[model samples]
Target: MTPAKTQFSLPDDFNPETLMVAKVTEFGVFHEVRRAAHLAADLVANGAPADLDLAEQILAQVLDRQEHDPADPHHGNFYWMREDEFVEDLNAVEFVLEALIPMMIRHAARLTPALQERLLAAIKLGLMEVARLDVLVAYTNIAALGVLNTCLGGELLQTPEIATRGFGKLLAWIDYTNRSGHPLEYNSPTYTAVTLRSLKLLTDLTADAPTRQAARALTARLGLSAALHIHSGTGRWAGPHGRAYQPTIVCETAPEVERLRAWLTDGTLPRWLASFVDRPMASFSIQETAERSRGIALTTHQTPTFALGVASQSFHPQANVLMLHYARPNAPRPGVLYSRYLLDDKWFGDAYHATDRTKMLNLPDEGRFLGVQEVNRAIGLYAQIGADHFASAKGVLIWTGRDEIDEIWVGEECITELPHRLDVDQAVVVARR
Candidate 1:
């Protein structure tokens, strides 16, 4: 069942048995192929889409997001050289191509010859051009190119010089993912999607022996990470880790529907979509500890209704502050269970619905997340509410058991709690409207 080596032209050091698992139990990429296949079958049985405009619409959307001019993609996942005019993210293009791959799988049998040719040509051209531009974006982007190139046919490898560079780059990417505990240095729900999608393509497209050896291993690790991080119940990614956008909003420009409109129509989407992974994920469960750099320790937990991702203060920094993404609330996009990461940008952190914000002055930086569940980031640094200064608010309610309040300088900004002492080991505080 394995394809020929000539098709992949892999590096000599590759290994074939990398990360081979007993069975496949993941989603996302797995279901993506299913969706594509379903669509292809429907098209073949019913004929091409009546609305010829669908293709054009997807194409246009991709074009709009292209950083044809090197503007910051604002949402970045890692460190990379920047150039003003260079295109930054081709994710739109990546999505369109991935969306088309499933249909391409059944093209010969179901698609009209002309339709197949045009669509294939368009998809191939889009991927190749993006590949060229991706040479600048980042390694992950380049890996995106490598996966696309190999799957569509060894076209990028058609020329010897280009082939050497192209395949070589993929080898390097595989090497990086394998050597580093967290291949995705800056993890995010969206970036995880990108990484998983690329790996999915690699699993299917590349040759058997050499090229996939290292790729298989990394794919397995990344795949496990994806399963653990996502809420099985809601099907949404966990946390706004590193660089991520609201998954439901698509792109931030167009808005009107309250869910779609920027938080205040004051035209600031970040304000509204600033909470935790609020959407519903269908089945949730913890897969494993996500291994990352700095011996950071993070554990993932999932149940049918919700998911919990905890990072040891010593290990995971950004997300270590408690994060809970749910699939049970059955709510709209601006999902609740807000994340502490949002508190990083203090200026914009006050999500209208969020209350109970507090800070601890004496805790070590690592322990800060324990007492304070809020966070705000400046440029790249973290700033919190109760860390140093006093924050004033209204209708704050606070209650706790007999445990002495940590000799932490106590400041109750809002007088919401009854003065009567309650009995217990835990503290309960809820800011009411």
Candidate 2:
């Protein structure tokens, strides 16, 4: 049977160049954040992020007295804990909480007033925590405030303290650059793009000229326009390990678009473009091996055969089982074969030594063999490998014909029911020529 057709929606004003830029930038930031979380967790665990003498000094002063106490009952004793253990867990929690703060605030206006107030309190607490640790809260925090401002309309902006703190943070990120030991690691092109967007939003909300100029200056300095062009077109970024980094899409906004446009036209593209080129690919196959002796004879041509065709191969090296398709040449076949290798001579000799009913049932090799779940997994693996290899071979089986059967197909019902079988455990591949 033929597959059903799929449909997709397109934007009214779709431009490939603009869309590409937006997509790359958005994805880049997402990738950076994910990487940062992992990196931060590792660094914290190693006692690196909090090991800095200056940052620790600042943290010591900023934390409450209870936090520093060796035996405070209410403080949870988290601050006084060993740096290695505490930092890793704390950094992970902080990363998640920091990320959630902006996300919660962004969706706050759509929620009930109680939820909005709760989210605001959460954001404030998160901000204080991150600031106390000297961690920079950038575009995410700025965007969260933008959402809150939009929701609250003019009332919240009327407060000078709120306005000053929000605008100040936004401006600081705009001018932010890597300096001293504090690395200005912009997560992705998208992050910078989003920051530009937040600045635009701030300018729109308060008509702040200085913030607008700062945003423009940041765009010029970062060469965001050129970066966007390169990223959207053919440019690539490589990580420290010489692996190409592919960004994931997350945020798409007007400011991001503008920044991308500017990056393409301007000459400030980053040097990491060389890392995005094509790489290599690999594939694998399987074969059957056996031993022939007088009474221990086991050949594929032998009659009363308890053998079957090979089903699937695994991508990983440690995986041992192979799925078998039990469909006959013309009959409406319903069964599947799960062949397992007998590692021990004692088990094989005792199990298949005789066809006695009682003996066969009691044999460990026969009874404790392949399970149903394994048989199903093998079938699924067969389908996956088949499809991938089929496409790779340009719709033709490359290794089949003369002496080797390169490809095979199975019925839909057999594949579906293979998983639900109760008798079989892990499936194994055996020769059945």
Candidate 3:
């Protein structure tokens, strides 16, 4: 079957001036890079799943679009409405492509050897394009891309000449980033951590003892405590000072590095590593307590708005009670409730809750048997009441103002037994039923 034609069209209501086209382009690059890395790691840890085939097909379409569509500027430079309008900086494209190379290799390995060979051939061409780009490449991007290439060099189909060139470019990028006094946009504690990580991977794969030693020395300079302190204050892993600074996904790095270090040295990654690595490193303790339902004990600690992305919901009796406890600096504050449920096999819910103040219903038995079922029942009842009778139905309820709700449910029927995403605004008194 012929592939669906890729088209570029601005929305009818598209207002180009209000949109940050450059920022969006950068975000796209960053997202693709991170996604590629994540998928690579996943494939390596758990053999290739069938979904990968689907991903490959999608990627192929994207590649074709990038290659053939003149209307679609290769660097996301053109505004959707004005094809002639071009943005000068296309740095993000190179960074994103560089990051994607390693991910593609990992993906290739999971395929048949013949397919793997074909992928490697395609990757070389892509890498060449990435390397030849004229955009002002950042050290972080170069380092990240270099590390991936180093890790997979032995397995990829690229010529030794191409591999060596790619490696050199990566090193140059890292050197520039490390030495440049300019503040990094992605600077933060986690930025340092991921950079170190990429360096370590490169060191390990290339068996470059000198490079490894240098990277270790740099890491040591970025002290664990210093990184943590920075993260606590700024909620990121990036340069200590820079105007281009922004929040990072990998905010907590010291603990993660320590955990990875222990695992590498002792041959066992703690089960806690999974959650610990994902959480804001500084707030790991609070997150853990929230997950374990040990909220009452954690009252002494400060709590912020809790946001959790649920991967699976198949645990136990209290599984439904996904308690999110936040600490208020002053007296008791009302809690906000927002839930994303799977309806008819498709997930739906406002990204933000519309109701802001739902009266907290006192548990029927004064905290005797409050559990998941009771909490869900309360929530379900709230949904049934047409946004009015929610409080009268027993149990705590909160009205997320319409402005707060961002997602819309998209399914024909209510879905159960699927994971739900939840976001709560304040500390909730999860009383026992």
Which candidate wins on lDDT? 1
Q: In candidate 3, residue 341 scores what lDDT?
A: 22
Which parts of model 3 have CA positions greater than 4 angstroms off? 1-45, 48-59, 65-100, 103-107, 134-139, 142-155, 166-194, 207-228, 231-433
lDDT of 2: 0.28
After the best TM-score superposition of candidate 2, give how far the Cα of residue 169 lies from its true spot, in angstroms.
4.7
Q: RMSD of candidate 2 to the true fold?
A: 23.7
Global lDDT scores for all candidate models = 0.38, 0.28, 0.33
Task: Give the residue spans of candidate 2 off by over 4 A.
Answer: 1-109, 136-159, 162-183, 186-209, 223-433
Give the Cα-based TM-score of candidate 1 against the true structure: 0.45
Order of quality (lDDT): 1, 3, 2
Clashes (backbone N, CA, C under 3 Å), per candidate, total: 28, 18, 29
Cα-based lDDT at residue 415, candidate 2? 31
Give the per-residue lDDT digits (tens) of candidate 3, residues 10-96: 234322342212212211311222233234334333443444553454344223323323344443221121121333234333333
Off by over 4 Å in 1: 1-89, 100-105, 108-128, 135-142, 150-166, 185-187, 205-209, 212-215, 228-322, 325-381, 384-433
Question: Which candidate model has the greater TM-score, 1 or 3?
Answer: 1
